[model samples]
Target: MKADTVGQEAADGLLPVLRELCRGAGADGSLPLTPRALHAAREAWGAAALLRLSGIARVLGEVRLSRRAVFHYSNPDCPCCRHKLTPNERAFLSLVRAGIAGQKTAATGAALILTEGGPVEPARNAALALRGVWSAGPV
Candidate 1:
């Protein structure tokens, strides 16, 4: 993940935002993975992370690609997604937001999972659960 010009943390943290952006796609059908979309995402995320998240969501059967190169998530408002996250989840969110925004997680001894886009990718995908937990990390 770090090797992809973006750190693992930000890459993970942006998943929820990416998911939401996809949710916001709504009646539009799909959102193109373009620079315009990247700009619409909070500055805490970058193009690389967005692309990676899009890929991961695609693999997870969450995002769908259309002939026009646009994508949308499977379910925008699943009931299970409304629950609160755990401490580890919060930690990952903090690190992800920090990394994307070019900052650092304030938590001491915060050991977070890292990856280079392999099996660990699924673990990183779970960070998408951090959607509603970003009240402090980043917008």
Candidate 2:
């Protein structure tokens, strides 16, 4: 199958595992993730993928983890190349922020930009350092 198709299928299969891990890890389920919890979640997801239990593992290995637990982006392609971001790219990024966990403030969600190459640890680390800029005034 095509890489994109494989990635979608893998992500589809991985979501349940992630949810289960979140529940087991005592995730709020509603609120954003704590740094520690996000780490655990990332590890759990990676392990699941590593175990070859789901296709997501193959794609996930390529994702980079962002500081915020969830990333929101309109396009699924590489921002620079405009090419479709491969499953490996997503997985590599997913792992990038495995160490970060906290409520983001500046943006409601993060943007997972696609880049070509092996894992970019430095960029991921920088992203982790950013304090979540919470939304404006009172709720």
TM-score of 2: 0.22
- Candidate 1 residue pairs that clash: 9-96
Lowest lDDT 10-residue stretch of candidate 1: 107-116
RMSD in order of candidates = 12.8, 15.3
Per-residue lDDT value at 118 in model 1 = 27
Kindly list the per-residue Cα lDDT of model 1 for residues 98-137, writing each as its tens digit.
Answer: 4334343331122223222224333333334333343334
Lowest lDDT sum, 10 consecutive residues, model 2, at 130-139
lDDT tens string, model 2, 93-136?
34322323323321112223432333444444343432121111
For model 1, what is the alpha-carbon lDDT of residue 26?
44
Q: Could you say which candidate leads in TM-score?
A: 1
Model 2 residue runs over 4 Å out of place are 1-85, 96-99, 102-121, 130-139
